[model samples]
Target: MLAGDGKPKHILEVNGLRKTFGGLTAVENLDLRLEYGELRCIIGPNGCGKTTLFNLITGNLKPTAGRVIFEGREITAWPVPEISRLGIYRKFQVPSVFEGLTVYENMRIPYFARMKPSILGRSSVSRNEHQEIMELLERVNLAGQAGELAGNLAHGQKQWLEIGMVLASRPRLMLLDEPTAGMTIAETKITADLVQEISESSNISVMVIEHDLGFVKEVARKITVMYKGSIFREGTYEEIQADKDIHDIYLGRHR
Candidate 1:
């Protein structure tokens, strides 16, 4: 879709978005956009409203002001499930997976949710559905661990499994909040590669909130820096890194 300005509409747009809790303003007039198939990173010190922005966009929290637009449609204050149905899905900082279920079983849930079969209908997985699950598992590097219980997987493996589960929902836009948290350097690097591959192959627009500079440098095609509940800067990874003001914010040289 094209906007009135004769530009291609962004996959996601947050215009004058704001959120507040009592006297505290968590997000302040934040405007951001994600182009189709773009991989963008949001980086800021703690309390800079990165996660809060995700919350507002995903309908976990209604904004005090402004709009959340997805695919040129206004979705402000839509319920969480409604937003999710509209093709937005998020992975929280902590890995959320079915610990008691096998990795393959965990992958089935989102597919089932998407399919929404009749209660009286056969619940058996179709041959094509089975193939789809396997392909998704392979993409997340968990095909070998399909039969293993999710809780038994390593922390990084669990994270990957959860990501695969999210992907099975066929989201047009994916929000990953600190996806590499608690991962080692090697795991982090692998995640960067996986995210890039997903973006490239699936044509999914991905917005990531990350605190790790290394991960941001590796994965971010573009970066947005937030400070004091608003955008401080937006640029390429190199440009962001070269900015002394951003450095000062990270180093606590400025509030």
Candidate 2:
């Protein structure tokens, strides 16, 4: 696909994405694409293999058969860390912040540690990197609690911290799964706004998998509805929300 400028429309493209555990298939021959700097959402019912597809894309798990191309490069089955270092970061369904460390400490670890060369074990974080981390905490509204242990943060706050950690990688594409999963109404709204801001300010594409339709509607410019291990529909928020076929399949009303 190409935009009006005749440039490639998407930065990441997945063709024939599939995953199987023995004879059980989780994702089956799925195909989808994400444009640069686009905020897209994937929504589906439990056991629909949304996470499975994410893991495949991020190289946390290998696809049984597929091609994952990013920026005109083939990345199928690349190791997770290599894929991450290549500017792809995935936020898990559960918050993965370091529980024992303070918010500041958690963010700094990845910020500094990731800079170290894997083989040489050299680390370098400029003073500006340190300053930016503080700014990030403030932006996330957790600067006051930067001294508090990450284990003590509320569910939503931890979600924010995990997001901060992913930012430390300076990724071009971020895959966030259920970012507002355990948040309250207020926190959910706040998290959604933060994602919108990050996608805008960072100029990075973000593909989020969220169950809350209202939240997805708020954060996403485009929506990809998936079910039975395949795409059901793709469109703008209003288009998909009003799509009776999407609703029918999601509601068990589609055959």
TM-score, each model? 0.95, 0.92
lDDT of 2 by residue, 187-226 (tens): 9899899999999898789999999988987785888888
Give one digit per residue, the lDDT tens place, for model 1 in 97-126.
989999998998887677645642556888
lDDT (Cα, 0-100) at 190 in candidate 1: 92
TM-score computed on alpha carbons, candidate 1: 0.95
- Tell me the spans in candidate 1 whose CA falls farther than 4 Å from its real position: 1-8
Question: What TM-score would you give candidate 2 relative to the actual structure?
Answer: 0.92
Off by over 4 Å in 2: 1-8, 117-126
Model 2, position 18, has a per-residue lDDT of: 88
